[model samples]
Each structure stands twice: as structure tokens, then as C-alpha cells.
Target: MPALPRPATGPGSRYTARAATTRTRPTPARAKPDIVALARRLTARDLWLTALIHEHRVLTAQQITRLAFTSTRSAQRRLRTLHHYGVLDSFRPLTVSGSAPEHYTLGPAGAQLLAAQAARDMTDTLWRPTSTGRIAYSPWLGHDTGVNELLTHLAAHTRHHPHTRLPLWLSENSCARRWGDIIRPDAYAHWTETTPHGERLLPFFLEYDTGSQTLARVEAKLPGYAAFTTATGTAPALLIHTRTASRELALRRRLTDPARDLGLRLATASLDQTTDTPHARWWMPLEPTAGRLTLTGLAVRWHPLTPATGLEATDADTPLTLPVPPLPPAPHTAP
Candidate 1:
């Protein structure tokens, strides 16, 4: 839930925008935004972007492009305009030398605009945002943005494959509400891939990691997944996305470890690094071969979790079937 506005000294208010940060030499004139021009240029998509950033908290420029636009150039252009108009605020994380991509969150105007767009009442008085210093100095900012990138890629992927339905996408915060202390994933989603035989609903928990997480640390999360499934008898797959192929390889060992038993079926993949698009070729399984498989094809690799019933019927005369839990509610998008 979005919090009410806080005092200026509030350290980490999600609803508040930070003091403006200058990328280069200070451009004092840019402080005052051209609100009128910005309002004139706003699109429904722009308002959607505002709502998205509001929901997810922060997004890098690349994630925004994948989520809302066809290309990075166009997305960046709009982001710059939004920032200039004080509708979106951003800061770059500390890099070794070269510049880092700007991370964005909803600005005061953007949040208010989104609330109004959603037909929600806005009665708060102190509408200021988090301080720029707080965002820049946040320790988990990079990790949070990495999770956003993974979810954004999944969100974008479904857009291209009309047959693939992303029914329920719960953010980390949303997951916290749904699962409480039972099992909190970086993101939780139910994907239904339509096929001639029928469709299969894949409920999975996302554990997106940058290169920073050690394999041991990765293994530590296994018990939680196992416990969740044991308690609910609803064993969802665990999809891990890492920064590097090496990291993916190392994590795979832990995921498929023979020594320690883990309940959740697991698959691993590297972050989508090639094109703006995501494809089956980008997803790798535990101890996978050279050829990659589509999301549902992953079922072949986790037989215990997804027991095969037989060859899926290709013709209308034959109906495809699988042994699994009762069909889930028709896929619906989570707010």
C-alpha cells in the first residue's frame, strides 16, 4: 500500500520524491518543470507508466522500455520529458567508473496523476517525495531494480506471445501480503500458455539475482520453497534468473543438488541480455543441453513437479491431459 506523505525529515517514504539530483554540472534553470507542456503530451500509456512505476517502486530505463515502449530511445526520450516535468524522478547508482543507467520512481505529480487516473481519492496534504540523497544512498536499490528488470522482461515477454497469459503478477510487496511470513518471493506469477491440446497454468516464484549472491546464499532459500510446498501441497516451480552464465551455472548446482533435498522444481536462466525481446532460447534449465525450450517445454525437465500424461494430442479429435491440481481460476491480472 502507498503510504501517506511524511515530514521532510522522513528517510524512506515511498510516496515522497527526493530533492532533485543533477547528473552533470548543475543546470539550475531545469529545476522548474514545464507542467503545461507535459500535460499536453501525456498519453494513456504515460499514465500507465506512472501507475506501473508507482506499483513496482523503481525501474531502470531499460526495464521501462521493455515494459511500456518498443525501443529504448523512445522510452528514454519520454522518461527525460517526464523527469523534466517533475512527474518522474531518478538517480544513478554508484558505478566503478562509467555512468550507470538512471533508476526511476514516481514523482509527486506522477503519483497524483496516477491516483486520479485510477479513480482513487487523494486526500494527503504533505505530498513531497523521498529525498534524492536517500534514493542515491539506498543499499538495496540495485537489487530492487534487478528484480524489476526480471519481472518487466516476463511482463514484456507475454505481450509478444498472445497465447501466453500472465494472469497473476504479484510484486514483492504484494507477495508479502498474500503469503505473509510463509514464503516471500521477489515476485510471484501464474502463467498460462495456450496450446492446441489445451493450456497449462505455471505458478512460479521468481528469485532474480545479480552476480552479488553467492551459491551458498542461493541454497539457503531452498528450504523456504520446500516448506511452502509441503505445507500447502501446492508446489510451484522456482525460476532463477542470474546476471551471468557462470553465476547461472554455479546456482544450478545448488538448485539440482543431490546431497540436499529440495521440494520445488527448479529452472535457471540468465537475464535477457540480447534483444529487447525474451525468447525460450534465453531460458536454460537445470543441467540443460545446448538447445533451449519454451516456458511450457520446461515441464519436460521437471517430471516430478509436472508429471507427463502422454503425448499432447495434436488434432481436435484428441484432447490433451495431464495429472495436476484442479484448474485454477481463469487467469486474472493483479492490480
Candidate 2:
């Protein structure tokens, strides 16, 4: 029989062999929890707690109690609820010798849940009209001082228009769907108009662009509208751009060809950046008949696109009144 080879006999040889074996061994990956499922199981209060955990990473019950303004017992209950629902995985014990204070961490599931909630919140806030049925407006969308000024002006214009009822159809981070297969405008004004026959539906579509000088996203949406017009035989009546003269001029140049091809009408409004009020206050054009108007302004205004329930207007002292035409009538159906 062939002689069996002897194992290497050298100082540190065993250690080297053991080290190689250890290096080749695979480390098990940590298991992540099901965030979506955990979110579904949470109540409103539980969701709030989960959000804090997801944002801050790990929080202790005592800390959460103070931050959430809850009693120690209530905070403890909330923490236990999350852990039981699998929103949180392992917890760190406070100490080895005393009563263990648990520190919570968002499991994989919790992280996923928070992300999905944030996305939903963004979508809802962006597209929905305000509770007051007022026009939706946003300043952050404005790319620069010029664009901001324009938006401010447009907002003012809408507010001052008595003939035009500019109800918010969308705001930043709001969700909106279209009519049938057609692309609808970002914001809408539904007002009754006294036509020769009687009251008729007069819906105005408003589009606000900040003139960030990037039209990639806006241009992509145009094709959908173009297709819709071809199929439905209707196009948005108004396209508004809030931008500097140069930027607006440039947009006009680029959009002129498409506008002509799509049979879309464009409206341009200029905004002044020096003012520190809502853009609506500055840009909205007042009706000729609006002789003596009372304007009430709020320091911080809420989005009009959100559904209102018993929420008073932020500032009633300085209400804005203009001599615009009276609203025709409320739509029988919700927009």
C-alpha cells in the first residue's frame, strides 16, 4: 500500500489551517422583518411610533415616552405592540444587573413600511385639492427666485379671480388621476357660468411650472396629453408658466412648436421675488370689476387641496375679497 502522507508539522501550521477554514466559512446574513405586513397590522398610534423608530433608528421606551408625550405605561405598551407585530426585531437590554430597559430598532419590515407610508403621503398631498376647495399652490417647486416670483403671482391671480373658481386639483406630493384615459390638468377651477341658455360647466385647467429650466418631465407628459387629445378630441385650455422673462421666453420657443402641433393654448405670468407673501397674493390678476376689495392674508397657509373638516381658515382677519363673478354652482359630482 502507498504510504499515507503525514500532515504538515510546523510551528503555527495548525493555526494557519484553522485560519484558512475560518476565512472560507460563510457568515449568515441577518433576517429582515416584513415591513409591509407589520404596517398593515399597526393602528394609527402604532404607526406614529413606528415612524419615529424608522427615522431615529433605535429609541428607548423612556425616550419615546418623552418624545411622544405619553405616560411610561402607554409608551411601554406601544413598544410591546410594535415588537409583537413584528415591526421591530431584536431589542437591546438596558443593562445586565438591573431591570432591563428595552431599546427598539426598526426591523427590515419596519423600514419598508415607513418608506411606503412616506410615498403614499407624498402622493396624496401632491394631487388632492385642499379641503376648502381652493387652488393648490407650492413654492418649493419654483427652481429659482424668478420662478418663485411667477408662482406667487399666479397664486394671487387665482385668488383674486371672482369669475374663476380656482379649486386645487393637485399640490406638491399629492396624488391625482385623470378623466377616463385622458391626462387631466394639475389644478382645476370649477365654477358655474351664466351662459345664454343657463348655468353651464366651466372648468379651467391650470398648469404651474417653476422654470427650473428642465422640461424633461414636463415634456414627457405632453405626449400623453397629445395622445389623449387625438383620442378624446379635447386638450387642456390653459398652460401657465411661472418664470423669468428669459426662461419663459425660452420655454415659449421650445413649446411653441409642440403647442401648435397639439393645439394647446399657453398663458404666461410674471412674479416678483422681492415680496414675502403667498404667490397667489401677488400674481393673480384682479377682475376689472373688483373695485374695493378686502385682502386677508395668513402667515402660514395650508394647502387648499386637502379635504377640510371643521378646520377654520388660518387667518380670517385679513381676508382677500375681489369683485370677481360669483361662482356658478357646485359640481353635482366631486371633481
Candidate 3:
């Protein structure tokens, strides 16, 4: 028999595990879309959506609506338009349930336009024609969508509420780039809540769990976070969002010993437990029973934690030469 080829391996193998196992959908042979025309037709919001899709790898129609649009129907209408224009591509995963929401990724013309706006060559953008297909077929698609869902809810809250802001939201890739040595959180964020006295800031590392990994594997992540705190002299409260209430209980039980030993500020919330929004009193501390607390309440509870330094643009050790602003651009107003 002929020898089989070795699988691709590198520093990024952990992130690309699904790539080797899953086959990308074949692209149909068709004429390339008019990139220049699409670029000219792109609006501020359209460009922002393209950039966001590029950054996060994938977003569901519902998530995009929560992040930008005013209504589900309108968002769907606009998304259809964009998808038809070859500016966005989408896939609906087959679920045991009736149907799944459409998930969106940057299309070919969108990638070219985005790269052009950034004054970079197509090769530098790291986007390929098959990128969307890879995302669609990956097992991690649901987990990624869940991560975006939580953050988008928080970001969208600012629209209706006054004096609340999501100042910073770093994706898994961004978090890894910044703090990969000691610990790489699924997401790192800053939420500012207004108090009568002044403003209170909540900096947290999010671990969105789908209950796929073993409890041991989940509990094993604590020491790295502790080491990070010790090394940086800054502690960000860790919030684990679980799929079910039972899973949250299991994790809390599994993690309590080490989390206490390491003196890590940890909390867990489950999807079933949160009735209103993520901002509601859903998060429960890993410690003894009291009651659920809001995200801001967790901030107040973990007062000892400090905002991470070197994250600002003026800081010397900042990761990106120019950090991406957390919020998208405001709608252009007619003067």
C-alpha cells in the first residue's frame, strides 16, 4: 500500500484541528464578482459588518441583528441583499431541531474591499475563498456563535440603557495574542456601569462553555489564570458561561478547591438561569450559596481586581500598534 501523507502541524494546530478533519464545501465555477463596484456600493455599516465578520470568523444573523440592526426582519432583508451581492456568504447548520439560524462570513469581494481599505495586499489579510466553508463545517461553529451571542447582547444593551458602555471586547485570537503565554481566555472584556457615586469598571475573562469538554479539562485552566495574575499583578474576574444549570453546578463543584487555593475570582452562569439578559443577576460565585449577581455586582464584589495595564493606546507594551476600537462606528448623521 502507498504511504499516507502526514497531517499539517504547527503552532496553530490547536486552532486548526477541525480543518484537517472536515472537508470544505466546493465552490462553484463562476465569474469573479465585480470587486470595484461592490467596494463603491459599500456603506459605513456594510464595511463595519465586513470588518467584524473578518475579525470574529463567523457571526449568526441574530447576532449581527443584536449588534447593529433595529429589527430581525430588517436585518434579514439587508443580510439577504449583502449575501446576494457577494459581499457576505452564509450557511445554515443542520440541527436535530427544526432549523438553525443562518451564520455569516465575509465573502470574496468583501475580503478584497476590506483589505483595500486597510491599505494591505490580499495576501496579508489571511482570508481565502474557502475560509467561509471551513467555518461552516467546523465542529467549533456553535461554540464560536455562542461566544459572539453573549458579547453582542452586552454591546447591544448600551443602545437602550444610559450611562453603560462596553469599552473593550477582545476575541479569542486577540486574547491569545495579548496573554497567550500564561493564559489565553476565550474572550477579554471591559464593561463600565454607572453608579450614583461615579462609574464602576468590570474587567473580565469569559469562558463560554458548551459542556463538550470534561470537567477535569475545564478545571485544569485555573492555575494558568493564577499564574497570569501573579505575573502581571492584575486580576480580571473569570466568568464561565455554561450551557445548562446542571453543568454550571458541576463546574463550580469541580473548580472550587483550586480556584480558592489560587485565590482566583470566578463565577458561573448558565443559559437557563438568565431570564432577562446577560446584565441581569445571573452569575453565581463559586463560593458558598448566596444568590445570583449582575455583571456589575460581580465587579463590585471583586474590588481587589484591577484593570489590566498596557492595554491603552498610549501604553508601551500594548500588543497591537493600533488597537481595534471595541464599538463599531456610529451611524452617519445628516448635518
The sequence of per-residue lDDT tens digits that candidate 2 reaches over residues 1-335 is 11122212210011111110111111221344455455456665555555544332334454455444326776676566555555654333222233323445554345556556554432322222121111101122112222223223333344444433333222221113233244544444332323344433323344555443265555555666567556654433344544344544455555656765665434433333223332233322222222211111111111121121111233321111111121112221211
Evaluation by TM-score, superior candidate among 2 and 3:
3
lDDT digits (tens) for residues 273-300 of candidate 3: 7633998899988887747999888888
lDDT of 1 at 56: 65
**TM-score, cand. 2:** 0.33
Tens-place lDDT digits, model 1, residues 105-194: 767567566545444543321135554456556655666766765556667777677787665565676566456577667877666777
The TM-score between candidate 3 and the true structure equals 0.85
Residue 128, candidate 2: how far off, in angstroms?
Answer: 17
Candidate closest to the true structure, highest TM-score: 3
Question: How far does residue 96 in candidate 2 sit from its true spot (Å)?
Answer: 49
Task: Rank the models by TM-score, top first.
Answer: 3, 1, 2
Name the Cα RMSD for model 3. Answer: 7.3
All candidates: TM-score: 0.68, 0.33, 0.85
Least well predicted 10-residue stretch by lDDT in candidate 3: 5-14
